[model samples]
Target: MRFATVLAVPATILGAASAATTVPVTYEPKYDNGNFSLLGTACSDGQNGLVTKHYDTAGSLPSFPNVGGAFTVSGWNSSDCGSCYQLTWQNNSIYITAIDVTQQGFNIALAAMNNLTGNLAVQLGRVSASYDPADGSKCGF
Candidate 1:
């Protein structure tokens, strides 16, 4: 149960060019070949029973309207996975795939991001996320 709490700014504030909204986003650590929890999903094929990764899907819990599958990123649209986005904090920035969404999808483990552990929450400089075309990148978002 590793998690990192991040402040998401509304896309409106960024400009009309985007429609993303402000929401509290928490990212957890995920590993390759991990099992899908009741609210979990997978990024590759052959992993049945779990929802296949999709752009429109959000890592929502099974209790949500479409059960284990629903593509809702608060301010983003469905079928928007094949896009590339940037997450910036302080002087660090990482490019991520808008690839998989889960009701409980783990983005990147907080442990890898920072060495500290134990469910800690920290405020980062005006966190900004922006999206662009995926450009044929692989390895899942």
Candidate 2:
């Protein structure tokens, strides 16, 4: 009886852990110049320079083109700084680093937004998304 109880507990925990949380996802226009400085972010002062170390610039377009994001304070806490989240929209998904805080929803860089929307980010500024804590490997940790 004891062994069965322990087994059941583990299974229940695993089942709950596998569930992803859903949120609204929007795009911000800060990556256009390829500048990934953490100067104005909430994590700028305390994340051990993780954002600067991992965020990379890709192009000089006038649109966001990076794999970074800001989460709403109500949904994510300070401990999530420098963490990664997999954002899914429709049939697309992308991994983004949490480097800042927003007022509402997950505000991702435009590049990540475009990817998730199949290059329709301009047409679809916001989308409903399912998010899960993901391996930071994809976001360069």
Candidate 3:
């Protein structure tokens, strides 16, 4: 009887081990392959006359514009207060850069779109000092 008990213990242990799910974890928890693209769109807070550009993409990591291969251009946050955002990439990497308003003009145009606010543009050191759009000389604005 004692001999049978010993055999039963080992057999039970072996059965449990073999019965475990045959999942492919690779010690990696999960697996992923990279390939990607981005789609950009512009949205406006029309009531406030503010336009925002949005970029969204799925695919993999190596296809971003001007960003390089393997080294992903994903995952980013702008530390520049007022203007900030975060980006995530499949390669588990990150890159952060300023959103140049001058190039897109979305942000600047939003500010100018409101006729009421356009009046204030002259005071915020805009178009040089004293809000003189026609002044040939720089007012250190």
Candidate 4:
């Protein structure tokens, strides 16, 4: 009976580990200059439309011209906050965090995309960011 209980525990743990879903991600180079100018100010989140308002995270301001493969995902959800993703694009693989969301849920910033792929004009084929449930890294979350 003791052996059977231990075996069941491992199986249950494995089952839960396998439940993490792989989300497909695609992004285009689009600059959100509106949000760029408001950093470090009271209205940085979107006062008078001075910037493109991002989903507020506690007290952090959205980094504009987003760098370092910083990405935006679907919406503010408890399950999504503090999640990490393994993004891959032709000969390159980087681990980036999911921040905000837009009509196109998963997107890489213009500057960050440019850094990832040398030529912004080059179309990335089958780009994807795989979510890893165990990661505890937080960006805007």
Candidate 5:
């Protein structure tokens, strides 16, 4: 499956996006058409479920939760079908704070505001991909 990444940076005087060590995140990959899996050969096991990829290992996201879902990426908020954010943190060690998210699909959407702190990064609690009929590509984070 094609993967996108968002980063959150904390521990600094002000929130800044910095480089950090890599971590693997796992989730299911769905096509924009809403039917079948975008699960690529990279994602080999279905019964085992999807695999978590390193941010450096993937693409960009729509939002960045402040420091560990505590804050937003500098100046960004939720915008459905909008762009994604790469939230990250820094200090002794850099890591993922949280994924600030937006996209449209299914019956549920991410509409909660979080204020987290510490940790370089945190994996997404969950995700739902909606099928875009025109282009037929994945566009949800």
Candidate 6:
């Protein structure tokens, strides 16, 4: 019985460790040209092209531009770029590609913010959300 109890403890700990991580989410208005170039996007050059082709099939601007990869600014790297996550806020969820890194949480695109907030982006500039890894095959994973 003692061995079984010990096994349960490690299983519980592992479950907690693997749980989805939640983070703050904010919005950024689109650039004048309706692109994310001015923000010094890290993945805009090549990875973004692949991201767009995979996710932006509706002919709309890509969503979820900024992400706190590894949950820190300095922690972000090329490997984190172009990663995809499913962000959940309230009862809404949206898939976002990690085009840039941010220390202020996941800085989403304005269009995505609107969609997630039911067109309340103007009223709610920031919110708490959780993210989980999505299928990255389309993102060249």
Scanning candidate 1 in windows of ten residues, the lowest lDDT window is 61-70
- Lowest summed lDDT over 10 consecutive residues: which window, candidate 3? 23-32
Checking candidate 4 for backbone clashes, the offending pairs are: 34-51
Residue 60, model 1: lDDT of: 34
How do all models score by TM-score? 0.34, 0.68, 0.15, 0.40, 0.17, 0.61
Q: Rank the models by lDDT, top first.
A: 2, 6, 4, 1, 5, 3
Off by over 4 Å in 4: 1-74, 102-105, 121-141
Q: List the residue pairs that clash in candidate 6.
A: none
Model 4, poorest ten-residue lDDT window? Answer: 41-50
lDDT by residue for model 6 (52-131), tens: 33432212334333232324323323565666777877869877766665775677667777767788877988888877
Candidate with the greatest lDDT versus the true structure: 2
Q: Per TM-score, what order, best first?
A: 2, 6, 4, 1, 5, 3
RMSD in Å for all candidates: 15.1, 6.4, 25.0, 8.2, 19.2, 6.0
lDDT by residue (tens digit), candidate 4, 1-141: 355444345666778845644444455443333343323322223322112345332123333333222233233342343245554445554454444444432465555455545544247532444444234333332
lDDT of 1 by residue, 9-93 (tens): 9877778744533322344444222343423333323322223433223333211111121123212233543334433333344
Evaluate model 3: give its lDDT.
0.21
lDDT of 3 at 134: 19
Residue 81 displacement (Å), model 6: 1.0
Scored against the true structure, residue 131 in model 2 reaches a CA lDDT of: 82
Query: What C-alpha root-mean-square deviation, in Å, does candidate 2 show against the real structure?
Result: 6.4
lDDT per model vs. reference? 0.33, 0.64, 0.21, 0.40, 0.24, 0.57
Displacement of the residue 137 alpha carbon in candidate 5, Å: 24
Q: Which stretches of candidate 3 lie over 4 Å from their true place?
A: 1-76, 84-107, 110-126, 129-141
Residue 128, candidate 6: how far off, in angstroms? 0.2
